[model samples]
Target: MRRPDPVSRALTQVGELFALALDTLRAIPKRPFPAKDLLEQFWFVTSVSWIPAMLVAIPFGAVIALQLGTLTVQVGAQSFTGAASVLAVVQQAAPIVTTLVIAGAGGAAICADLGARTIRDEIDAMKVIGISPVQALVVPRVLACVFSAVLLNGLVSVVGVLGGYFFNVIVQGGTPGAYLASFTALAQFSDLVVGEVKALIFGFLAGVVAAYRGLGTKPGPKGVGDSVNQSVVVTFLLLFFVNFVATTLYLQLVPGKAA
Candidate 1:
């Protein structure tokens, strides 16, 4: 075989990584859904994460509405502002933005937890006892994130719409009913389903990527922090990359209509 160029080698490595991830997914145990674990995950996403994500989304919505209003005033078709705002925020802003908040807030917490576990030799101990670390550690966290993301995205979508409307109707006194009508008319079930699907993928990815990095930490104090930081950076990068590819595939190649 001839020597490969740097670009080709990098691509090959990425391919291997994807293949390994697929293997891991297939290896996941086919067990009953853990209700208690899911409940806890819901709590984390709802009570813990929902408010913060909403807080971030609300301000984001306000800013978008303000900008949209300013832009549309000259065109005299400001009635479309609400539809525009909702479409923009829901696609990538609400769910994707909530993922951002989660990475900084909840994601860091998860990273630190795993890092500490690794540092204290708990992971080693689990392996020593013939336990699957993926099941004990990775699965629960992943489940929690996936569940939490659904709730957080739902909250963000609702709050984002309301927040955008508040800015449009209350702040700018734009036509609230007209905006709502436009949104309802144009908003398809496909958009909502796509947003939810994105949230699920994003949430699962956030947990797995963060846990993987965090669990790989050396058994030390500094290692814990370093892993957490790295987890955040890596997960952030993956989130964007996945978004681009997933959305492209979703819009262009995927079939069966929107919903």
Candidate 2:
């Protein structure tokens, strides 16, 4: 059966979020960004996932070195493993992984919490009381996502690099410093720039998508479940597709190509 258009109401909430983000930005007449909230959000995201990330990252880093070793040796390019691993982890994996982690854990949690409030008419009650749910509910989260993504990406970069180093040098007896040094020699200023820029954007995306899904929640358990599932799937896909677009645009405008 076709579902009713419960989503129509959500458009308003989504618009409000964009406005909040924009208004916050515009209020800063001198600066181009909102650093404090962004930083706070980033720290929250990073701190919240520290334990899980540490647990997973160590094994992931170890396995990557072990797996790449066989392939690198075949081409007699064992030395390039560090550089290749670093680039792959930093440029490719980190942002996407952070998004997934947030979506699966933080995003889902937000959606459910908000959706529960929505089902119980708490959101409607807010509207009745002249409360700006956008400010009260959405702003913190949107800001959190933006900052969290940045923070997590930074954390990811550090862990990824160090993990690759330990695995290569200690575990596999490979030249570990190659990966750390690769950023200096192989990567451009633009590469790091775009990666971080994309991280901020991705964070907003995760928040916006999550909030949209959450606010549209209907008065039922099924609706909440659907919202959470959809939020994660949509968000993860959006991150990758958006990442691709950003990379393409960067190469077209910037001095160097990503390839």
Candidate 3:
């Protein structure tokens, strides 16, 4: 049999991944849902990810405040720094930052776990026992990833806002009151809702990609590592594309005044 070309193979792989995701989604409401496993994976994904997420968020928030605050100062609209920085974090930076952590850290962990199991034939063993691996493993993990991402998005948003506040107030010499006061001037409830929705969608996609790469890994230890790496790379690519589309749609749907 002739091997499929690279493009064809890639398309086929994507189709398989999509199908797997659909199957997992269907498995979600099936009776005998794995609550314990879902909770454990949820905690594990969130707990293992928060420190890195915070580390990333602080610099991200600080940089935005530093740049936007400086720009606003030049224009003599310095008091608007809070509104700009807060909106930046709430509408864009937080979800992307949290997703970077999820795709890099959480995706790697899930891929490694599933890859190891595949290399050990554990997945096959479950299949031989008449168990549906998607029901048993993928559903819990996908849900856990989505849940963890939403939670982490909230965490990142808080940390990012705090970082922006400190940098703008102390380093940039903006008044604390100015920073605090301007936050409500431009921000809206819809911005937070959009950010969380982005987080949820990103998390679900990352989990599906990771699980697909993990379970479909080739034989051997090297294959497992390769799968983990591919999972991260693919997830990142998908995320940036998704982020662009989501942000554009969000801006269109809920127009906000520039601060």
Candidate 4:
């Protein structure tokens, strides 16, 4: 028999991933919720991701502030530097950083763990005993990612803003009052709402993609490693695409704060 074409294979995998996401979501509202698993997974994800997310956020925020500060000075709009830098961090960088950390750290671990189980036949054993691997395993990990992402998004935002503030004020000699005032002048509360929303959606996507790849592991240690890599790459692409779409919609639908 002829093998499927590349496009067809890709489409088939996409369909399988979608089906797995649906199955996991359906299992979420069922009885015997995996509270214990959820707690443990949440702790694991948070522990692995928090420090890295903060460390990354500091540099990310500093770079944004420095670039924007220089540009604002040249344009004679220096007072808006804080608003622009902080908004950029809160709206874009925070969620992306949070998702990246979760995917690279927590998501990889989830994929590898599940893939190992698949190789060992533990997943099959659960199914034979009438246990849904989705509920018993996937759901907890997914929800853990969601919770971790949301919480880490907030943490990154705060850390990023502080980093930006420090660079702008101390290094660039920007006035503290003007910097703080500019944020209130140009930033709407909706900006923050959209950022958190992005974190929530990104988290869910990361979890689903990781879990899907994990469950589809090809039955070897090498396959487990490949699945983990694929999960991270796929999640990164999906997160960026979804972030663009969501940002576009928000810009078109929501009015900006009057400066």
Candidate 5:
């Protein structure tokens, strides 16, 4: 039989991952949920990724303040600088930062761990013992990714806002009261919700892609390396595409009018 084309093979792999994700989701309602596994993975994900996420966020926030603060100051609308900073960071930067950490750090870690297990026959050993690898391994990691993304998004928001405030007020010599006062003037609760939602979905997709690639890895060091590379690349592509679609729908549906 003729070998399938690369596009055909790629489509098939995507469909397989989707089916696996659906199966994992279906298993969620079945008791007893793996609380212990979830917590352990959560701690692992957060401990590994938090610092990097914060580091990226602070610089981004500062840059935004530096650019926007300068522009707004020239127009005599310095107070609105804080609001713009809040809107931009919370609505876009924070979520993207969280996703970068998830796709780069967290997803790579997951892929490496599972790829090691795959090449070592641990997965097959679990299957021999009648344990489902999806339940025993993938589910907990997925939960951890989602949980960690939300947690990191919150940290990013705080760091980004504080970084913007510090840069705008301290470095740029803006009035403290004006910076703090107008911070929430144009932001809405919907922005926070949407940001969190973006983080959640990005994390879930990252975890799923990593797990799928890791599980399908062949028995070699090169295979594991390829899986890790593919995991990061695919997760990033999915993230950007999803971000566009999600942001568009969110803006259309909520519009997030300030109170």
Candidate 6:
């Protein structure tokens, strides 16, 4: 038999992922919500991701502040540095950093756990007993990721803004009052709303992708590892693409605050 072409294989995988995502969504509103599983997973995700997210957010914010500070000075718009940096952090960097941590830490763990179950035939056993893996396992994990991402987005945003503020004021000799004032000058509340929205969607995508790859694992120890890696890589790609699209739509639809 002839093997499927690359495009066909890609399309097939996309179809399967889409179907899995649909199943997860449908399973979400069903009876007997897995609150315990969700709480456990939420705690797990938070425990693994929060410190790393904060560590990364600090440098991310500092770099944005440094770069934008330099650029704004060169352009003779140094007073807008805080607004630019805060907007960058809150509107883009925070959600991306939060989700990256979620995908790398929480998503990888979820993938590995589910993949292990798949290799051990536990998923099949559940199916045989009329238990939906999607409902019993996937939904809670996905919701956990969503909840974690939303909360972490807020945390990262605050940390990032603080980091940026410090770098702008102390390192760049920007006035603290100017820095604080500039934030309200250019950033609208919608900027924040978009960031949270990105976090929510990105979380859902990360969880679904991880679960799909995990459930599709081949029967070997190596297969579980490979699925975990693939899930992270796939989640990262999807997050960036979705972020770009979401940002573009937000820019088009929501008018920026008057400077």
Q: Which residues of candidate 2, in runs, are more than 4 Å off?
A: 1-47, 63-68, 177-183, 255-259
Alpha-carbon runs more than 4 Å astray in model 5: 74-76
Could you give candidate 3's per-residue lDDT for residues 1-259 as a string of tens digits? 9999999999999899999999998989997899999999998888889999999999999999999998998899988899989989987899888887987887899999999999899999999998989999988988989999999999999999999999988898899988887887778899899999999999999999999999999999899999999999999899989999999988787778555
Please give the range of 10 consecutive residues that has the lowest summed lDDT in model 6: 178-187
Per-residue lDDT over 149-217 for candidate 2, one digit per residue giving the tens place of the 0 to 100 score: 777777766776677778778777776456456445566655666667888888788887787788888
Name the lDDT value of residue 104 in candidate 2.
72
- Residue pairs clashing in model 1 are none
List TM-scores for all candidates, in order. Answer: 0.85, 0.77, 0.95, 0.98, 0.93, 0.99
Residue-level lDDT tens digits of model 4 in 119-217: 999999999999999999999999999999999999999999999999999999999999999999999999998999999999999999999999899
What CA RMSD would you report for each candidate? 4.1, 5.0, 1.5, 0.8, 1.8, 0.7
Model 3, 126: alpha-carbon shift in Å? 2.5
- Top-TM-score candidate index: 6
- The lDDT of each candidate is 0.77, 0.71, 0.91, 0.96, 0.89, 0.95
Query: Which should have the higher lDDT, number 1 or number 4?
Result: 4
Local lDDT at 189 for model 6: 81
Q: Between the candidate structures 5 and 6, which one is better when assessed by lDDT?
A: 6
- Give, for candidate 2, the lowest lDDT window spanning 10 residues: 24-33
lDDT of 5: 0.89
